[model samples]
Target: MIDGALFVVVLVGALVCAVSAGALYAFSSFVMKGLTALPPAQGIAAMQAINRAAPGPAFMVAFLGGALLSAVIAVFTLVSWPGEGGPLLLVGCALYLFGMLGISAVAHFPRNDALDKVDPEAPASAAYWRDWAREWTRWNHIRTAAALAAATLFVLALVR
Candidate 1:
């Protein structure tokens, strides 16, 4: 029964990681470009609005939920290591919990918070917007890579 439950959690974690990768991918692939192309004030407005709107339940479920599920998967795999999919699960956990969640906490959210403080219409805010766009996008690209890697690792764990 424990093994069965662990299997279910692993599956859910994989799905969540995949979903997160998609979200990060969208931001890096086109959203940033779209925002960067707009007039400085308009871009800042849109970015601030986007940052404001991005923190709802759906995202929280996938982001925080994935990290939580990965932690569980790691624990379960440790107990059943070698005989089960131990290595794969542990790797997945590190990638999702450390790579994805850790990077977001350390790198991305702080930038968002800083952006929130600057008034988009102010003269300095335009410069802030430019710097913010480049730096945020760079970190987001890192996030996208980490999330996609986590998703791959989780899916592989299931197959193993």
Candidate 2:
């Protein structure tokens, strides 16, 4: 039998993973699509507001916290190595830790941070906005796919 506490950890990790997936889904589906409809400057302004607010405590919990929790899941899974859940959890670890969070930390954050430093009203910010938004959304698509996959695997892990 799976340890109750460890099962709880897996379930909670799955839930947190879902939150990350959902956010990426929203961004992939409507958020970026909506942003594309606006003039680049307006889009940049909206994105700036979003980027600014995103690092706040609540989102950070879901964002960075989920990643950290997933790392815990990965480590615990390695140590405990539950029967059917083992491989699934390992796969989830790769997807969540490297695929989702890795891409976010490595690719997305730097881009956002760079954009944050630029003046949105400047003549150059338009091009920067266009490039940044497009690239960010592309990377976001990767995040969405990886997170969704991880979530599915986690669910499987939970049941096993």
Candidate 3:
């Protein structure tokens, strides 16, 4: 019974996280597009402003929410320890969690903390800000990709 419950939770959470991960990946692309459409200096300035603003909190809410849901699944998996693929799904969930944490601890949180020191409305160095934004976005892309991959593996586990 518990195994059944865990399987259900993992399946559902994986689906939700996968969708959200894809959405975030697309959003990054959208931001890039928006930047490209702008004049070079203006684009750099806008990206800088956005970076200083630490807009990731909103996304983190989603990421963390998904993670919490997955935690339930993880607990279930551990308790139940279903068939062969069950372990794989759990591994996927773990990877996803690590990726999310990596983004938060390594990339996003630091950027946000730094942003707290800087003025989003009036940046000190547009060049420095641009560099930071690019780096942050790059990490975000990696995070999102890993999350999606994890979600995919989890879904595959369901099929197996």
What are the runs in model 2 whose C-alpha is more than 4 Å off? none
What tens-digit string does per-residue lDDT give for candidate 1 at 6-63? 8789888888988998998999999999999998899988888888988899898898
Collision count of model 3: 0
lDDT of 2 by residue, 1-160 (tens): 4557778877877888889889889998999889878887788888878999998987778777668878888888888765658888889878988889999999898988887777767888778887788899899999988887887888898876
The regions of model 1 sitting more than 4 angstroms off are 1-3
lDDT of 2 at 121: 77
**lDDT scores in order:** 0.83, 0.83, 0.69
TM-score for candidate 2, residues paired by index:
0.92
Instruction: Give all candidate RMSDs, comma-separated.
Output: 1.8, 1.5, 3.8
- Kindly provide the TM-score of model 3 when superposed on the true structure, using C-alpha atoms: 0.75
| Candidate 2 lDDT score at position 123 | 89
Q: Among all windows of ten consecutive residues in candidate 1, which has the lowest summed lDDT?
A: 80-89
Q: Give the C-alpha lDDT of model 2.
A: 0.83
